[model samples]
Target: MDQTTLLLFIAATFVVAGFVKGVIGLGLPTIAVGILGVVMAPAQAAALLVIPNLVTNSWQLSGPKLKAIALRLWPMLAGTCLGTWAGAGLLEKAKDGSATLWLGVALVLYALVGLKAAKLRVPAAHEAWLGPVVGVLTGVSTAATGVFVLPAVPYLQALGFEKEELVQALGLSFIVSTVALAFGLIGAGALDWTIAGASLLALLPALAGMGVGQAIRQRISAATFKLCFFAGLLALGCYLVLRAMG
Candidate 1:
């Protein structure tokens, strides 16, 4: 794609991704990375997501129980950082479209889990050991595919946090994931000034889209939107997988 077209594509993709995030409390990086993966390497797409993901997720961190959530989730957060560091350069080094293939697989699995509406419950006793395990898996996936939703989201949901607290927990986890992924990308020499600037510029439209989504959130059926979101993700994931294989 030419420069102008690429720029337009990036902008439009972020708008839609941001809107999804606003309504659902997550998916900016997943949607942006998956769509951008069609035209660019996963590492490059991940670089473009750093700023937007960080800023948007940071916005979601405002809540009364922030400290409590942080305290409760520290093990997982630390594990994510360590796992991401260990997995650094995987995407950059992937050969034969492997990164794209894995990205597609990640999306497909995530979509299926969401579509299934699994109501897993994590007993408090097991959280101490299980959280870090899930975090490590999530971090490794993020390092390879530029997506971090897998077991992390599911695990967080299983914790049975109330609605607002769950949102805050997701925000905190995403913030850590974004920062960890950014560092990983930087270590791999994938992120630089140009990508950072473009990512920063993408933030405006993202925020705008978020505003529109938030405005409509009260009026729309979240369950219906979620159904469509997962369905789209499933289709997109299959397409990416086939494209990679072909």
Candidate 2:
């Protein structure tokens, strides 16, 4: 694609991604990375995600239980940082398209789980050990696929937080993941000034889309929209997998 075309494509992609997040309260990174992977390496797409994800998730850090949540989730967050750092070069090293393949697989699994809407409860006794393990796994996945919603999201859901708390926890985790991923990308030499600037520009369309999505949420059924979203994700995942294979 030409320069103008690429710019337009990126803007449109973020708009759609932001819309998804506004309606569902998550998915900006997943949607943006998955779609951008169609035109570039996962590492490059992930670099573009840093600014948008960080800025958007920062607002989610607010809430009364922020300190408690941080204290409770510190081990997991620490593990994410360590694991991401350790695996920071995976995407850059996977030069034979394996990174793209794994990205597709991650999207497919995430979409499937969302479609199933499975409910799992993690006993408090296991959390101490399990949280860090899940964090490491999530970080590794983020390093490899530029997406971090698999085990992390599921494990968080199983933590038994109330509705508001869960939302806040997710935002917190995403912020940590985004920051960790940014460092990982930088270490891999994938993030730089040009990509950072482009990511910043992408933020405007993303925020605009979020506004529109929030407006639409009041008029439509979230459950119905979620179903469609997962369905679309599944298709997109399949396409990515097939394209990578070909």
Question: For each candidate, what TM-score against the reference?
Answer: 0.98, 0.98
Computed on alpha carbons, the lDDT of every model, listed in order, comes to: 0.92, 0.89
Q: What lDDT score is found at residue 64 in candidate 2?
A: 98
Clash-forming residue pairs, model 2: none
- Model 1 regions lying over 4 Å from their true place: none
The per-residue C-alpha lDDT of model 2 at residue 244 equals 85
The CA-based lDDT of model 1 is what? 0.92
lDDT of model 1 at residue 33? 92
- Model 2, stretches more than 4 Å misplaced? none
lDDT of 2 by residue, 1-246 (tens): 999999899899999999998898899988999999988888988888888888777777788998898899988988888888889999878888888888889889999999999999999999899999999999999999989897899898999998778888999999999899898888889988898998888899999888888889999999999999999999989988998899
The per-residue C-alpha lDDT of model 2 at residue 196 equals 94
